[model samples]
Target: MSRIILLIAKFSAFMLFVAQVESNCPSKCDCNPYSWDMNQIDLDCHRAQLDTIPRNVPLTTAKADFSLNKLGLDPGFQLKLDHLHDLRNLDLSANFLESTHIKDIPDSVEILDLSANSLSELSLDDLPTNIRELNLAKNGIDSINGCSGESSIQSSSQIAIRFDYNAIPILTRDTFGNCSASFGYIDLSSNNLHTVEHNAFRGVIQKANDSLVIDMSYNKLEIVPFEAFQDAIFDMRGFEYFSLDLRKNPLLCSCNMSWIPMMLDYFQKMGLKGVIMGTCYGPEESAGRHLEELTKAEFKSCTEYSWLKAEIKARTEQRIMPFWQVCLVVLACPGLVATVVLIVGVRMHVKDYRRYRDYVVRKKRQIATQRRRHHFRASGAVGDVLLNSSIKNSQK
Candidate 1:
C-alpha cells in the first residue's frame, strides 16, 4: 500500500512539469510536437496576421515560422529574440518588410527566409554574419552594399545567397565585394542586368571543393563579358560542379559571339557538365538561332564593314614607318655618330697642342741657360790672360 502511494505522487509531479511547458507556449501560436517522440515543440504561427513576433515565443522553439503575415520592420519595433538561442530556422518571408535595418536577430539562425518582402536595400549591418542561406528574392532591391574590403559573407560554412527578381541594372566587380564568403550559388537571374563588368564574379566564387553556380538567365544580357570569368574558365580542371545558366537572354549575335562556341567546345573536351548556351535574339537574320549553330561566316556578316576596316587597320599597324621618317632616322643616326666623333677628335687635338706648347717653353728655357753659361766661361778666360800679362811686365 505504501509503494502504490509513492507511485501516485511521482505521476502527479510529472504532470505538473508538463503543464509548465505547455503554459510557456504562446496562446495564439499552434504549438505541435517536433517529432514522433514529442521531445520538443515546433512553434508555427504562419499567416497569423501577426504585427510582431509573439511576445511569449517559447524558449524551447526549434523552428519558428512567421511567414505570410503583415509584419512591417522598422527601427521602432523591437525584434529581440534573445531567449531563443537554439532557434535554427526563422521564416519571416512575405512580411511587408520594406527596410532591412533589422536588429536582434538570433545569431543561432542558419536559414533566414526574407523573400517576397518589400526590401529595397541590403547591407552588412542588416544581416547576421552567421547566416548560411539568405533569401532576398522577389524584392525591390536596386543595389547591394559593398563590403569596402571589410568582411565577406563566406564563413566556416558554405553560404547560398539569392538576389533574383530585383532592379539591378549593372553588376560591377564591387557588387558582391562584401560577400567575402565563398558562395554556393548566387542567383542574379531575372534582374534588369544589362552589363556585368569585368571580373564581376571576382570575390563571390568560392575556391572550395564544390563548384559555384552563377545564374544570369532571362535578363538583358547582350554579351558575356570575357573578363567576368577572370580567365578561370580555361582551367576548369578540379571544380566538382561549375555551371553557368545564360539562357533566355537577348544575346546579340555578332563576330564576338564566336566565343560562345569556343566555350562550348572547351566544356565538351573537359567533360564538364551544366552549360546551357542561350540562343541569339538579334540581327534580324540570325534571330532565334542557337549560338553553337552559327558558323564563322554567318557571324562575320553582322559586322561586314568592320572586317574591311579591321583588315585595313591591321595592315596599317603591320606596315613599316613612312619613307621620310625612316630616312630621317637613318640620317640622324650617322649625324649623331659624326657629332660624337668630332667632339672626341677636338678633345684629343687640344690635349696634344697643350703638350707641344709646354715642350716649346721648356726648350726655350734650356737654350737661354746654355748661352748664359758660355758667356760666363769666355769672360773668366779673358780675365785670367790679363792677370798673367800684368805679372810678366812687373818681372821685366
Candidate 2:
C-alpha cells in the first residue's frame, strides 16, 4: 500500500512539471505541444487567423518561422515585434509587407528574410546593426542608402548583403556610406541600373579591407563613372578584389561609348581580370553586335568621339618634333658668316708675318753702323801706345 502511494506522488510531480511548461506559452498563441523545451518550441503561426503578432513570445527562442501568413504589417503588428529582443532569425518572407514594416525592424535582430515583399524604397537605417545576412531579393528597391544613425554595427564581422532581381534604376552616390570598415561581401545582380553614380561605393571601399568582394552583374548600366572607381583604386590604401560583371547591358555604341574601348584597352594591357561583356545598341547600323565580334573598322568607327585617342595622338606628336626643321635657319645664317670671318683671319696673319720680316732687315743695318764706330776708337788707342814705346827706346 505505501509503495503505491509513492508511485502516485512521482506521477503527480511529473504532471505538474509538464503543466508549468505549457503555461509559459505566449498569450493567445499555440506553443509546441509535443516538447516542453522553451528554446526549441516551434511557434508556427502559419495561416493563423490571428490579426496581430503575439507580444508575449518566449525570450529564449532562437528561430521564429512566420512564413505563408496573411499577416499584413500594419501599425498593430509592428508594435508587437518591438519587444522581441532575443530573436536571432526571423522569416517574414512572402508576406505583402508595405514600406512601413521595413522601418520597424528591431535593431537586435540579426538575420531577416524579407524577400518577396512589396518594399519599394528601403532605407539603410531600417537594418539593425547586428544584422549579418539580409534577403531583399525580388523587391522594388531602386537604390541603396547607408544607414544614417548614431549607433553602428558593433560586431567585427562581414555582412553578406544580397539584393537580386530588383529593378534598380541608378546606384546613387555614396550608396554604402555608413557601412563599417569590416564589411566584406556584397551581391547586387539582375537589376535595371543604367548609370552608376560617381563615388557610389567610396565609403564601402575605404572601410573594407582585402577580403571584400562585390558582384554587380546583369544590369542595364550604360556608363560607369571613372571617377567613382578612381578613388577606390588609388586613394583607398587597401587590397580590393573588385570584380565588375557588366554583361547584358545594351551599351550605346556611339561616341558616348569611347570610354568603353579605352577602359578595355587599359585593362587588357594591365592584365586586369574582370567581366567586360556588352553589345552595341545605338548609331543605326551596328545596333546589335557584341564588342568582341566587331571588326577593326567597326571599332574605329566607335573611336570617332574618343577623347582618349585624340589626347594620345596630340601627346605623341608633341614628343617627336624634327630637329633639322626647328634649327635649320638658325644654323645656316651663322655658319656662313663664321666661315667668311675664318678666311679673313688667316689672310691677315700671313700679311703681318711679311711685315715683321722687313722690320728685322732694317734693325740689322743700324747695328752694323754702330759696330764700325767702335772699331775706329780701338785703332786710335793702339797708335798712342806705339809712340810711347819709341820714346822709351831712345832713352836706353
Candidate 3:
C-alpha cells in the first residue's frame, strides 16, 4: 500500500514536468526528444512555409532541419543559433540566402549546409570553429570574402570544404588564403574553371602533414597546368588514400597535355598512394582515353617541333620531324660542301707542286749525265786520230 502511493506521486511529477516540455514548441515545427541523447530535441521545421526561424525552439535542440524555406526573403530574420548549446547539424540548404554575414552560429554546429542558394560571396568569418564539413555547392559564388586580408579564419581541426557548382572562373594563389584550415577534402568541381594558376593551392596543400582529396572534375580546362600541381603532388605523396579527380575535363590531349604522362610516371616512381582520373574529350583521336594509357606515338608529336612549332601541325608524326631535320641539313649543305671541296683542292695542289719539284731535280740529273757522255766520246775520237798521225811520222 505504501509502495503504490509512492509510485503514484512519482508518475504525477513526471506528467507535470516532462510532458509539459512540448507545450513550448513552435507551432510550425515538430519537437521530438532524441532517444540517443538525453533531454536533447530534434527540430524539424523544413518546408514549413517559414519566413524566419522559429524563436520558440527548445534550447536542447541537437539537430535542426530548417531547409526549403523563405528565410532569406525576410529582412528582419536574424539567425541566432548560438543559444542552442547542443546544436550540431544544421541544414539551411535551398534557402535562397545571398549574404554570409551570419555571425550568431555557434561552434557546436559542425556540419553546415548552404547549398543551392544565391550566395555570391562567402566569408570565412561566418563559419564556426568546430565546423568539420561545409557545403556551399550551387551558390554561384564569384569570390571569397576573407581572401583579401579583411579577416582570418582559424579552425581547430582539419575541415572538409565544398565549393562545387559555382561561378568560379580562375583560381589564384590567394583564393583560399584567409582560411587557415588544413582541409583534407576540397571539391571545386563543376564550374567555369578555365585556369588554375601556379601555386593556387599553396597554403591549402600542406607539406606531407596530412592526407588530401581534390575534385576538379567537369571543368573547362584545355591544358592540365602541371606547374600548378607540382607542390600538390609532392605533398600528397606521403598520404595513404588521396585522390585527384580530373575526369570529364575537355583536355586538348596535345603537347599541351604532355605533363599528364610525365605526372603518371612520377606518381608511380614516388610510390604515392592514390588514384588519378583524367580523360581527354576532344581532338577526335584522343577522345575518351585515359591520360596515362596513351602511347608514346600519341605524344610523339610533342617531340616533333622545336617547342615553338608545336602548334604548326596537329598530331604530326616522327616522319614529319625528320623532314624538318633534313631541311635544316639541306640549309647547311652548301657551306659543308664548300669546306670539304676547299680542303680537297688544297691537298691536290700541294701534291702537284711536290711532283713538279721532283721532275725538275730528275731533269737536272739527266742533263749532267748527257754532257759527261758527250765529252768522253769526243776525247776518245781525238786520241785515236792523233795516235795514227804520230805512227806515220815515225815510219817516214
Top candidate (lDDT): 3
Q: Write the per-residue lDDT of candidate 2 for residues 1-396, one digit (tens) a residue.
A: 999998898778657755654687655456553333343444565556545567666655556766666567554555256666666777777777766786566677788888887778777666776887788888887767665644366544667677888888878876776555344566677987777777776655544244455666677766565555545543333343445555576666655555555555544433443334567666668678765554434457654446555653454455545578669867787989999999999899889988998789767655654555465456787745654454354335
> What lDDT is reached at residue 40 by model 2?
43
Task: Compose the digit string of candidate 3's lDDT tens values, residues 230-329.
Answer: 5555555456666778888888788766756655554454555656688888779888888768654567657522342342232233224557788899
- For candidate 3, the TM-score is 0.65
TM-score of each: 0.64, 0.56, 0.65
**Which candidate has the highest TM-score of all?**
3
Clashing pairs in 2: none
Per residue, candidate 1 scores C-alpha lDDT tens digits across 264-357 of 5445544566364678888788899876676545544445335433433443444446668989999999999999999999999999999999
Regions more than 4 Å wrong, model 2: 1-43, 47-50, 73-76, 149-151, 181-183, 206-208, 212-216, 233-240, 253-396
Evaluate model 2: give its lDDT.
0.63
Error (Å) of candidate 1 at residue 268 is: 2.6
lDDT values of the candidates? 0.70, 0.63, 0.72
Q: Give candidate 1's TM-score.
A: 0.64
Which candidate, 2 or 3, has the higher lDDT? 3
